[model samples]
Target chain A: MIGVELRKLFRRPRTWATIAVLNALPVLVAVLLQLTDLAPRPGEGPPFLSAVLTNGALFPLAALAIVLPLFLPIAVAVVAGDAVAGEAQAGTLRYLLVRPAGRTRLLVAKLLAVVAFVLVTVLVVAAVGYVVGATLFEAQPTGGTSVSGTSLSQEELAGRSLLAIGYVTVSMLGVAAFGLFFSTLTDSPLAAALGALAVLVTSSLLFTLDAASPIAPYLPTRYWLAFVDLFRDPVLWRDVVRGLALQGVYVGVLLAAAWANFTTKDVTS
Target chain B: MSAVIRTTGLVKRYGRLRAVDGIDLDVRAGDVYGFLGANGSGKTTTVRMLLGLVLPTAGEVELLGERMPRAGRRVLPRVGALVEGPAHHGHLSGRANLSLIDAAGPGGSGRTRRARIEEVLDQVGLGGIDRRPVRAYSLGMRQRLGLAAALLRRPELLVLDEPTNGLDPQGITEIRELLLELNRRGTTVFLSSHLLAEVEQLCTRVGVLDRGRLVLQDELVRLTAPTGATVVSTPEAGRVRAVLDGRVLGVDGDRVVVRGADPAEVNARLVAAGVPVSALALQRPTLEEVVLAAAGTSADRVEAPR
Candidate 1:
């Protein structure tokens, strides 16, 4: 069932369009960095934007940072939002339910499909960023010097990149789950995607307010940037662990609600 | 024979409106049960309940000898259905849609899935167009594809709601013949329709519903058999009316409808009275009449024949 869902996902022109648009962001950033020949000052822009100007190998991390705030989540939202509601709108949900896939199993497959979409989009951005970074940015003068002045091996770089990509994937799960839950509530895919995005916007808004300090620890978007911690020299696990835990809670609660609602739905469509 | 589908006091209420009121239905194995009702008469709602698509507010549904919404996983594998209309991904080809649905079913190895899809597509007269996207299909072609999907699993019982809807006359006839052939091969069919003529021609047994209530349920032959009156048309209408006396149900133009009298007896009396009958025939109430009667409407409610 998941394989079928994946096939359906990849066959759509919208899926490829979304990936292309997402990859374009990193490409644009790389080209601009090369043309300007001026690195961003410290504490400006995304975390690694300035750092990548000196070491091309860190460009994947910078690309992830640039897109994570909006581009990546929006793409995730579109795919996840369309997961069930799109099928319902097309009048296919009734046939799918009647096949005895059982609502729970079908919902799980949809969630998995969204996760697969997130992985593919993230990897595409990272890959495109890597190639652009290598060609446009100057290689390290000392061959492979870390920001902290320690020499790094190829294995270490690959390991950190994998960990960083994995963290970003987990961060997007909350949005995927939110999109799926909204998908179950309505038949309009656009509404579902917007609803999920609305939640993210609200969470981000709350995170910036001093008055929302007490509730900040539980917000869905709070730990989204924690993937940057994986790139720290000492590899800080504090915010990363907290982010993972928060995402797990969001995924669990939202998916449980989705299952509860979907299994009892009348399926009038 | 054991019933393939049985429901007891099934009800589905949406807030203040009861879409499907308390009703009991029995569809025996090997019986072609025609579910009859007008639009919004709960025909679709009842079918949804039986298939576990809508949870009943108050009732029990036993499908294929297992309790529904509980054994739905096990029971649905043996039943095939097309509700309202065909619902498939318009972006996908007919073959892709069928393969996906087939993979979701309980049976069929990967090797046999292709063969089964081919057989059903051929059976439904869509053998050549399987590669076309559903978006390009006409209404009739989509309906045929819906039937092909239902037949993919070689189900023991088939439930189709308005299967011939949106079809041309030739298409309707082809579907009718196809359903009859499937029944001959031992697949019990349960279908719902508003067309009295279609049901009358296809079903062995039937249940009629009106405004969320079951009005009548019986064998098709028994329900439609002549039971009301004998119609006699004669040029000597005055003489015929005078001879018929109390047996006359009604008089319309030059014909007199007489009840509780045999055609031969009425003819003999009319001849004795010197009323030469141009036409003497028994009026077998059509299924439409029975439906109207069961619906509690007066016989004259329908438009009179010119």
Candidate 2:
């Protein structure tokens, strides 16, 4: 069933089209910055944007920062939200259920497929950023300076970059979980996607308000950018750890809800 | 013969509305069972329950000797079905859709998947179909594609609901022949439709539903058996009625209904009396008449609250 789902997910042109369109923004940012040497001031405008001007190797992290705020999550939400609801809308859910795919097993396969989409999308964005950075800017063979004002070794930089990518992927999964949970609740893919986005938008909105600060740490998007701390001199594990735990909780809880609802609900469509 | 599909008092209720009232459905092996009902009479709901797509509110469903919605994994692979209408991903080709559905479950072996798809496509008269996506296919083509998906595994029993929905006259005839041929090779069929003519022509046994209730179920032959009368068509209908005076039930435009189950006896009597008989046959109820008599008015009709 997992194999079948992966085939269905990757075989469609829409999946790849989404990945391509997602990379376009980061690539566009790279081109604009390449044409004009002006970079955003330090500590402002996408976490690592100012740093990517000097160290082309840092562009991958810069690209992650650029899209992580909106594009990536929206893409994940749409795909994950469409998982069950899209099938229902297409009238294929009944056929799949009658195929006896086993409700629990189908849900797990769909979640994995969504995770795979996130992983691939993140990788492609990072890869395009790397190529764009290398071609447009000077190489920092000696290793780029960390945000903490320390010069990191080449291997150390690569290791930390990979960690940041993994972190971002996990955070996006938090969005996917919300979408998947909503997917099981409604038969409209648009509604499910919007529902998932609503959660993220609400979390993001609440994170900025002083009144919401009391409960800020518990928000799903709160630790989304915690990966930036990976570039610290000694590495700041504080919010990073919290973000991972928070996403884990969301994924677990939302997935459980999706399963409980899907396995028992009647497939009238 | 063993029963292929047996439901004992199967019931499904959506709140206060009993979509599928308590009803027993018995479909034996090698039977072309036609399930007849009006729109909103819960035919689709019952089909869903049988396949475990919709759970029964009360009672039970068993397919191939195993309890349903429970033993579905063990049993559904052997039962092919097309519920409501055909549904497929519009973006993909018919073949792609078939492979995906075939791969979704256990029993469809990946190695033989292509061959199975090809065979079923041929069986459903789409063997020469091109690589065009299903979105471009006409309604008839889509219905055939749906049938091809159902037949991919060569299931032992087929449960098709309104299988001929969008087909032209020729397409309908072709599908009827295909279904009959499949049944000839020992495949049991449970066909649900509101087309009484289709059911009358193909069914060995029939069940009728009216407003969520199973109003009638019996062998098609039994349901349409001779009504202890004979019909005679003649230009001299008046002379025949005069001869069979007391036995004449009714007369309508050169056709006379006489109180005799034996057509041969009626013919002999008419010939002996010098009343030329153009046609003489024992009266048997048509499936439409039988269904109309057994079931109530259309369930789609809404009445004002008393």
Candidate 3:
């Protein structure tokens, strides 16, 4: 049932448009970073482009962090946000619910669709960044030594890229879960989408503030960039674990709330 | 026949407003029961409670012989519904929408599922719209599609709220006849609507609600013929008055007699007396009048089950 929902999400024009536009953004950013004086000289350390790309897994990981608040979150929101509210607005929810299918099943299917959309959005960003960054910056990927005093083979680059995509994908699940959470609360898709984005943006801002807060670990957004640490020589699994734990908590709470609200909703509106 | 759906002391309160206020109901098996009320009259709210979408503040709902809010999962399978509006995935074609829904149930071979889809589409007069995207369908067509989806499971109990909404007269007639046929096949229907005449024509039993409370409930015939019309007519007004003076019937001009009696006898007597009666027509009270009268008179209000 959820796979069917995922297919519906992919077929939507807005979903494709969001992916296309976001994919082009990183390419443009990479080009701009290379033209500036801030970029590294031939022998200098990794520049801003390299900071994003050559940090091996950190390149796409950084790209995800940049896109999540403005691009990825909204994309997830559009998909998840429309779950119930969009159905109600389109005058199709009542028809769907009338089936022998339980409301809980419908809610789960919609949430899972949103999660799939989020993963797809992250992969699009990572793939686009890899192609554009590798072509424009010509920097050898960091970590292992270079062969022939240059960058590694194509297979090595592909392996590193896939790992980066994986990190970005898992990290964005929080955004998708939150989007689904907001979807159950509103009858308007636009409202649910924008409302969920607002929450993501606010939490990201609070998480990055330079305050000496003891509660940072509890903020789900704090782990948004934790994927960057995964590319280290000795992979720092602590932040990755913390990020996964934080995401699990968000998913658990949001999904539970959605189930409770939707199952009991009057929905006459 | 035993009631297939019953509600005792059902109350649903949203903040300070009581959407469904202590309404009791009994719908027997195979009944084409009409639920009548104006907008915001709590008809939809009551149905939602029965469907287990909204919890009742205080009540017991028994559907298909099991108590609701507790045995909802057990009872819901035998029941099907189209609560208020037509809801479907706009991106998917109509056939795909139906197929997706059918897949969620006990898995079946593709051929059987497609056949089931075709059956409902044909039943609801939507056989030609199987391939069109649901977004392209007009409101009436979408309503028919919604009905088709409800019938896909071959549910024993069909609960539809305003099933005729957005439908043209012809479409309404078609749905009404289809419902009648379904009832004949032993499928109980619980339909909600503000159209009283349609209810009068299609429903055997009805429950009239007003402002979140049930004002009347009974077999349609009982409400329509509470007391038949009584017409008394005579060519000479003075003679008619003299004959009916202090009689136990309503007197209007040259006519007088007990209400609900046939007018033929009154007209025959006038003609025999060389009175040359101009006209005598019986006026039967309608369901609208009964509903209106019931809504107005507190004495006629029936208490809901507790």
lDDT of 3 by residue, B1-306 (tens): 888999999999999988888999999998899998877788888988887767788989999999886776566657778878667777778788878766654433467888989999999998877466888889998888888878887889999988998999999999999999999999999999889889999999999998889989898977776365565555466666454335336666766554436667666555666665666666557988888877644333568899
- Model-by-model DockQ, in order: 0.72, 0.81, 0.46
What is candidate 1's lDDT per residue for B52-115, written digit by digit as tens? 8888999999999999989988989788999999988888899999999888656646789989
Candidate 1 whole-model C-alpha lDDT, 0 to 1: 0.88
Candidate 2 regions exceeding 4 Å error are: B272-274
Quick one: best TM-score, which candidate?
Answer: 2
User: Candidate 3 overall Cα lDDT vs. reference?
Assistant: 0.73
Worst 10 residues of 1 chain A by lDDT: A140-149
The better-scoring model by DockQ among 1 and 3 is 1
RMSD of 1: 3.5
RMSD of each: 3.5, 1.2, 4.9
List of chain B TM-scores, one per candidate: 0.92, 0.97, 0.87
| Model 2 agreement with the true structure over B1-306: per-residue lDDT tens digits | 998999999999999999999999999999999999999999999999999998899999999999998999999999899998999998899999999999999799999999999999999999999999999999999999999988888899999999999999999999999999999999999999999999998999999998888999999999998999999999898898778879999999999999988899999989999998898888998999988998888888988999
**Residue clash pairs of candidate 2:** none
Q: What is the lDDT of residue B59 in candidate 2?
A: 96
Arranged by TM-score with the best first, the candidates are 2, 1, 3
Return the top candidate by lDDT.
2
